[model samples]
Target: MKRETNRRSFVKLAATAGLCTLASPAVLAGSHPEQLAENEETNKIPKKSWYPLGVFKNPVLESVFLFYVGSTWQRLSDVGECFDTASRIDEANDYSWSDQWIKTGNRLKVLGDACLKEHHEFTAGESYLRSSTYYRAALHHYPDPANKIVKELSLKVVKNYKMALKLMSIPFEAVSIPYMKTELPGYFFPAKLKSNKKAPVIILHAGRDSWAEDYLWVAQQAVKRGYHCLLFDGPGQGKVIRIQGIPFRPDWENVITPVLDFLKHTKKEVDMNKTVLMGFSMGGFLAPRAVTVEKRIKLCVANPGVLNWTASIYNGLNQIDPQLLPLFQAGNYDLFDQKIEEYMRTSSYVKWGITDELWKYGVHKPSELIKKYQEYNIEAVAKNIGCRMMVIDGTGEEFSVGEAKRLYDALTCPKDYVLFTEEDTGYLHCQPGALAIAYTRIFNWVDKYIDVI
Candidate 1:
């Protein structure tokens, strides 16, 4: 009832926008040559834009602030404290910026420990989560996987997250699901239902660079709606890849099938037939791909639907060199890797994007990585999806701007296309600043199509 009221208020203030619908099979065949050329030209030009400053310089820091908007407002973080700490960092120097983040994060951890000692459990829990968030923010744009500071901060993030989990209000289980030879780690948050009746479950996963902890805010929203939420670190994700060396594979069905098996057999509280699969960022591609093969999923949602991983890779690569494609197809990976590394050294954004992919894909060369991404195309498989689907897109999304429309057109199953505009304060990746509005629309759709209770 409260959420419904909030949704109505939001809808009243938000402007209605048209969805970019594409249904032609010919257009889905491939990216048009003319459009590719235009995209190449657009990538070559760096446009100056105004992003919120919050307490730091540059759009990256502003994006970070927006990403944590829900958490900060919910008291998981002290907004003033975060801003004060961020203000001290020298944003121009990556190493210095990361170091300041680590220092601030450590200070927060100490404060959290002090709060625990003083018998302030709620304060301590919130502080630990905030500390982990800060540590993760430190690594956001820092490219090198081998940097000792990066490794140290990553470990600290896990440590603080685990500490916070122990003190959270709702019961959460740190679970290890059987996957391949090794295990995949996850957190399962069951709904606090008074009855023993089965409840619908939502399995949430993150993109290439996001960790499971980053999804807590969204999970909390789902839990409030009486759904059990499972957030996991699959292959090539979070600690699984960062610590265990499991590279990403295009066949996410293999990964998600096992998770489904675990839930069906293990979680008695969950309604297996009502299970929904949701993925954010790169998971947009991964989730839909899985749902095509895994029919047990009742519903699927892809935030900014990704139809082709190859196109996504090319979009990022085009910023560096359009000639790189021939090198990839020709198997001249050694030269390609060298050139990419050289380009990475000059551009922080490129370095972060490319290096993260290389590490996650377990490839020594950019060409090899691109070759692996070629297997992740979903257009060929989209027609096979049996469940209802939702594709969300933002009008101002620069990365994969046309992807949602392409993916929507390819899907033959019952589907809904929702577009967020600047008026809704959600025309950014994953609607970072307007999650409340985003979740309202998402869950409302879920309730309409799927039985929630």
Candidate 2:
């Protein structure tokens, strides 16, 4: 593979916006994916609690058992649990929590500014806007309700959404992924845009611990290239997963059908005839499954796709050791009263076990969530995906490379596989390795099958 050695130079910003620091593992070797490979190989995200019936009977956990043999992202999932602590903070009043939320939002803004001004790509700026959206959503659910937090938070959410939306060239929309029937309280982002003529549509499914906002970078790219993008949060994603305890549903029919129906009825620009569904991380698994049933999806794209959720969870659980399995299984903070930082060190993967603050917010492990994944295996549906497909994998990504390759080989569609190296780009999970290169490849591929048809 030809490596792009001028990675730092290639990491450009979007004009004179601002400079935001990139979390490059180049300086921190321990944080690099390759460094933590040994732990990932041996440690299994314990199915002890994840699979009350044992790993064999549970297909999802069984799949997880197969995939995450050795991965650094699982270890980082433990450490990165610290990011959730920010969610635990009070965004409106509690000074400590509020300050943290503000700082995080501001830091994201700085990142966005850096992208807008320096990189010209403005991914950091989009990231900042995305984080701001989450922070505002958190405020909407603040326990106090002293000041009608929802109303106050909605204003900020709208502001951030508008700021992010204005930067793009195409029409944008926001949506609150309905969870258990209600629009997830404060979370919102644009969903679909109406085009005068038939325009190719992109349906985006978010990854674990992600929201619709995470797609700002990808959506912006799609719109500029003349595609209408639909970004939505699925169950167990973003606030719905974190706040409502709605675990993922493998029979994605329940989650995406309504969204598709809405698009079919509401948007003219969305070419129902030329739609593609794309997923990253967990969505990698999700988009594939959706395409099986939703024939409206003419093509599928899995960016660092996931074939098995059980394996994903098990891999994550393995990093923390089996001793703490009971705490995670119980789904409450009955075990220890450790602060968030210590919780990071002690728990198998910091967020695997439910926290007290989280429970106080009504978050709990609905065991059904795990069963949902177990019940909905995509391999059974892979043969059903008649659409042409594409899989993008980074050599540096630790999450699901082998699994993605297996799916790519199994897929019967006219498909292509794109790979990236760290020396050529940064170590990013969703092909952020060299985004310009990745996006170029994606658009070029779409143009090929799209125009000829």
Candidate 3:
């Protein structure tokens, strides 16, 4: 994968940037010398009642059911059935949620196939979509990215997704946007009712681990509100990383610029002047970062603003192993990687987090990966944003504790901050359990800022 070559080049670049504190023994030994307990106490974030069950119980499974409620995919009773089935399986400590989801997904897939054979297209399509969601869910938090099971499940996710696409009532077009040397894959859903009129476009991109398919719930919302939705997989994300081996870049503006150019030149039905860019999860960071330089973006929405990727990594690393910082500063990347891998082996959360980051960032060593996060910060560039911005965060968001406020404060442009609270059951990362409320607030904000109706 040329990972070693990339690592060498990155380290050389870091050295040129005068970030060689890792090479200093004194820095390695005493840098950021604070008690681990004190650090934890100072930065402690309360765990959500839904997360442990949602992530550990089913591993990326609940969001599908939660977001798709009242939609064609499945009913609440069906979701309850799946949840009940999941509850029967012992939560395997070895991070076997992948296997659990696959088992349940296969059951739904079989039912869908049977329905298809019986000429029940609507039932078959809906079940297939649900099964596809479950298949994709299986890959989340799966420790071994290179496992045969992962590949098998990934292929099924795409296959079943295509099956659902074929049967969906809404028009969906598979698109490939020209980028640097390669192409970015995506799906374009044009506004159904506004077929004869030019409509505002909402461009959405997923974060580090999510794919374009995962945004179906939100995209449907945009479509319902008479906005054309374009959901694409950018660099270091989805097919771009999985198939093309492109690592994530800090300058997302370059990626988005091409997309904007494509939309302007090709899709004449899209109202470019009223275009909005929306990002979820890590996209919360990537979207806003792109808008800082891309002036064509009239409105930007980041669901939980990510002020600095480095801060999040540093906080997580502090919780994992404060001593590892010294190794990072000392440039002993091999030892650092070994220690971090050892620590990750003890927890599923750490395992998934590190493995996903390593894969997405295309770095071999833990220190190199952490260092790469420094480039993703937007503090220095926030003032460049000239459009209306919306920053969303859950009051209980763990990873990006105070990032929403920090990002909002830094923005010199017109901006709005929304904090979903526990009483609304929207106070979790990206407001997973409250998609309706989130979308209502999001589109209402969008309508207020732009002509989306």
Candidate 4:
């Protein structure tokens, strides 16, 4: 009720101005020509832009942010429309909003992070469940009771989802403050086939611009093999904090502590000691950060660990148009008014070195965060980690393959590095298409070092 009231009030304030309805591909085509392939139409919207849902909500800003967030249905909708109109835009350019939706998403992520921080304390708390369910329902338009997707969820799946949601409902208490209070969303899956002992638990972490739901297939795969899995949207990772507004922290031990404690306290069918932490892309950075402090975490695995966060951002930003840099440095949109192409090209969020999102989410720049990163330095702590480890890297990945090797070499415990070439596995970043291979390699490596039984 509070959220709906807030959204309605905010929507009125944000979208009531001189706003435009739809953005023609013709406008975007001229500026985004470089994005087109040689065979593609220079003036047409890429096939990727035509959503089955008819651009869901706001067509303007969602169109832009979609490129950044990988074009999900929600951003293409009305919520996104709100973002396009909320910002203080340049009147000269005929745009009403500034960077509004991105900020909204970031703020929601922050509030969610705060809520989860409380939820972490109340792992089994009733209020937390009520609040979280409300949060999700609010986001999904409280899907109609007769919706087929809602109907199709079997009672068993519904029960499990509710069970997990119940676990997530627990409210945070002040007394639990001393312990780590990590912010990550999790998915729980029970093993399918029976095993000799409790099922192995895989803690899933995804990369930047990735959602927790993105790894459902992975958890499903693990479940089929009698492995229990938990996937959480950690700070800066998934919906709980990424799109909602939670900031990244260097001490990931805090981010992971809640889930680890939850697993240890409940879940009889799971062998907490058999737990493995797996991360992809930026998660490569996150999982390693937590593994060092949480000794109970049994395995540290990454799909191409991001060795240098700052460097990566720098590279991404440098690849964009050079002319847009002035608008970003000045934090002015005069150039945007002159030309939409100029503004987006130079947008700090669209640039690499521009750490605006971190700031927007209440985090320090990469340079500062990395200082905290050094405290949990995976390479330095790899020697201290007593658990088995696995590192997977795609040869064609734009990020460093060397970091994975460095981690593999530095790990004092038993470790394995599995490299998949384009020829062998069509994996880039998190072994995208080769998840089966990735899982097999990880389990095989872990089995060799520590018995899952």
Candidate 5:
């Protein structure tokens, strides 16, 4: 069949990408864009704007802090140590967050360098992973789209990730997945796939605006639990967006389908029937959307399940002006934009949010972004998902208030609705603060259905 040829062809092109070396993070990340694309947005969301998430008072700071804290089980984060640095940040200063975090990252990188020189492989790897994690937090609020510091910190993330990979006990590969006109960057942890046949494969999909390395802890957990894992930067994410300028597309089945092909071709021992599509954050939307069309997956996990991104956007629009949604629906775009522009002048949250969404969606105007997101809704095809589904809802979801249950209610297939309360550590969107409990429940549910043998 046509799909068969695509699978074989991917392995051929992907093999030429070669196994990346520890000294070559640039090659692993990908070549630089011919000319950097312009990012018109600025980080207008002020410190402590919306603090509903957890721990930290600011939403951005809370998310970034948990982005580091979530990895502590793998030794990639030191929660107590981070709290020390978190205290030194000056909320009145806009750049204070990145400055303190990047400083901590720099200190850890120096420690890693000395440990590597002393031949303490384990200690060096820990230092490198922790350093990479801190650098990642800094990137979240780092301003100036054209600043070289963005690229500098990005490369540091990849470099330290590679360095830590060198010291890992399991096999790790810096892989490239061939897509439409280019390749997608990925990490392949084969685990014991070759010797232990029938190994289940977990494909971890990153959220909007996140790098694969940002969620390396997810792959670490999967591999630790005996699953072959793949973490990749798809269109409009990580290097693909920054380096290649491809924006996000709604038909994620087009992306997930090819990834399945690549896995089937390369890892002969993997149990395709036991495949689990585990999505994080925005991936809650992307994963369910992909499963509606891509049926090869046997199990699908939507953490903080989202039924519709456009609906969520409309929710914000409604609050701004009860007439805003009606204006958009009536196609009065110029007037709608005029009103939105007026609102953006005063609301940092609205300004940064709309600007960030425009950049990620790769559209010039907010109207176009709305049209693009319209393709991302899963209501029409919810029944098309043939695989087992688990919809994860959280206690403190700032963006998606009731969307998870909405998705659960819409699905006609065999499904379960999971609520992550304060007790479950599934407090926020992806349960970054309580990663261990999140992963434990997820995999444990899979154990009940999938036969390892």
Candidate 6:
């Protein structure tokens, strides 16, 4: 038996998921198949309630559960019910996780609908938010983007999130950011502080697998601290990938530049001078990558700073029984692709990760995904980042092990590196179970550089 290093664990994460599409489930239920591991830069997201659930035997499902359940702190989910659902859902009995999550979401939608009928908007909104978070989490291990449920759940996520936003007592609006022959969809929540002064801004960015709405946790906290929050789905994220059909672009500065340009036109009192760019998950890389050129951001936060995302993706290549790199070097592309796909059959996480990324990136196969990712790194431009930077990382990272330190060491600008240890219950990527602590640390650090309020 081989010692599964951080990412090699993803191979097992697949079988741990044993997840199947909504289109087909019977064939995969209770059948855990082993998979090949290919690490990406997405190990930084997980949990709903901010308390990690170690009840599940499978680490992949553990991560999925952690991500959505940790949403309690954001008021997007109920931690108690999420725990009950996890307990009832058999971890090894594959393919039922998404279905069960949908059931829970449906139940909440019912309650929310009743609340709305009775004109209790606040209660209704809260229920809808939880419903949407469940629906969003359901997509975690769901393997096929072509499946109707993928789009169905995505629509439900936005629908519920919007309803919740509309019912809230905050200044909110939907925004369309002009891009190349298209527009990026986003949301804005102004701090609306009592003072007439412009509020400092915190631009929120979510990485692969998370949508624009998934970033509400950060925005919720920022708004409380009197910061105007801007969240947008870049190419390959949120509505961009779902509706407009745009793939990811390596030059993310193009994405952030337009966002910064649009802030002035928002007609709100936003302090552009104190703007902050904070990235989550794979976004940890995207945010810093953007600051390399867009200097308007006074503070840049990478939850786990990443160096060469391409190198990070292939970090565990040497440990595989038959290395994937050699196949590429020998031009045995078919075999290389076949081996990658073999994981799809064995692991739910691999299936979902590969398929979802392929669709988001507008690539046909796994190899093409790698080719596309090769263009998404900041090592060459790290020195060009003029803004103050902060790097965050947690121990026991599932995907990008040690990437934060690698990125922190590459910077030439003023920087800070914060490590979350297992003792603090922040061992998993992004400290999913300790979000309040995560945001508190971030805001306190930002406060040192700028007067956020």
CA lDDT, every prediction? Answer: 0.72, 0.50, 0.70, 0.47, 0.71, 0.73
lDDT of 3 at 338: 88
> What ranges in model 4 sit over 4 Å off?
1-184, 192-197, 242-244, 306-356, 359-361, 364-376, 443-453
Ranking by lDDT: 6, 1, 5, 3, 2, 4
User: How well does each candidate superpose onto the true structure, as a TM-score?
Assistant: 0.83, 0.60, 0.82, 0.53, 0.83, 0.86
After TM-score superposition, what is the CA distance of residue 329 in candidate 6 from its true location, in Å?
3.1
| Per-residue alpha-carbon lDDT of candidate 2 for residues 422-448, written as tens digits (9 for 90 to 100) | 544533456432446666777788877
lDDT of 4 at 266: 68
lDDT of 1: 0.72
Q: What is the C-alpha lDDT profile of model 4 across 315-338, one tens digit per residue? A: 333333333334444545455234
Candidate 6 lDDT tens digits, 2-32: 5344234445433221221110011112111
True-vs-predicted CA distance for residue 259, candidate 4, Å: 1.6
The deviation in Å at residue 200 for candidate 5 is: 1.3
Best by lDDT: 6
For every candidate, C-alpha RMSD to the true structure in Å = 10.4, 13.5, 9.1, 13.7, 14.0, 7.6
Clashes of 1: 0
Clashes of each: 0, 35, 3, 31, 0, 17
Runs of candidate 1 exceeding 4 Å displacement? 1-62, 148-152, 330-335
Error of 1 at 434 (Å): 1.3
Q: Which candidate order results from sorting by TM-score in descending order?
A: 6, 1, 5, 3, 2, 4
The stretch of ten residues in a row with the least summed lDDT in candidate 6 is: 19-28
TM-score of 6: 0.86
